[model samples]
Target: MTTLKSGDKAPDFEGVNQDGKKVGLQDFSGKKLILYFYPKDNTPGCTAESCNLNDNYNAWLEKGYEVLGVSPDSVESHRKFKEKFNLEFDLLADTEKEILQAYGAWGEKNMYGKKYMGVLRTTFVIDENGVIEDVFKKVKTKDHTNQILKSLNI
Candidate 1:
């Protein structure tokens, strides 16, 4: 499948949030959506990124953006991760890898000379009209939220 690019339509997905509520792209229609895909939950890098977003959650909201994280983890696992980190945003459970594949976040990844299929750390900034405004691939965990904020001119 072709990876999504700027101006591409963001894929619609149905995922359960940390609060066990179903959240989909349609639910965020008419609003800017910061949809990010990560490798796993509770890991150091993932935790840092999630926490950073949490810390600036209010600011993001003020700027009219909704932060949504997706990973190939179960809803229960997402709940634990969010509760552990006190994350205030929605973390979607993409257990089936459907959303991952649809968004082009699932693909080959290399670490220490070993290549394996996994989620490629990526972030998509969807515009209010549901079109992708920007795409950040192979994102660095640290200061990523700030980087996105800067890129969005927020």
Candidate 2:
């Protein structure tokens, strides 16, 4: 399937969160949602990016946005990552790669001169109406949160 683009209707999916709670896109209806897709949990870059979002969570909340992290990790892994870093938002377990594919975050990746299928690390800012407002592709872990913040002007 072709990946969704800005102004497209965000795909709705049901998944278990870090806390093992069932969540769906409809749960976030009427609220601005920041849906960030990362390659892995607990990895250096992923950790840094997630922590950065956690650090500025209050500011994001102040702007009336709900944050949700999605990864191809199992619920168990997500639980550990969330607890280890004290992540304040839900990290949806996309173990099936269904959501990643829908968002175009799953694709070829290179590491150590080896090519493999992996997530491309992206973020989508969806408005209250569930239409994607912004897309951040090939996110830089270090400055990712700041980029989103700047884009939202929050």
Candidate RMSDs in Å, in order, are: 1.2, 1.4
Top-scoring candidate (TM-score):
1
The per-residue C-alpha lDDT of model 2 at residue 59 equals 81
Q: Which pairs clash (backbone N, Cα, C closer than 3 Å) in model 1? A: none
List the global CA lDDT of all models: 0.89, 0.89
Q: lDDT at 135 for candidate 1?
A: 97
How much is 4 displaced in model 1, in angstroms? 0.8
* TM-score (C-alpha) between model 1 and the true structure: 0.95
How well is each residue in 1-154 modelled by candidate 1, as lDDT tens digits? Answer: 5489999988778988877899999999889988999989989989888888888888889999999999998899999998888888889999899999999899987899999999888899999989999999957687887899778787
The local distance difference test score of model 2 is 0.89
In model 2, the clashing pairs are none
Q: What residue runs in model 1 are displaced by over 4 Å at the alpha carbon?
A: none
Q: Candidate 2, residues 1-154: lDDT per residue as tens digits?
A: 4477788999888889988899989999999999999988989999999998888888889889899999999999999999999899999999999888988889888989999988888899999999999999868788877898777676
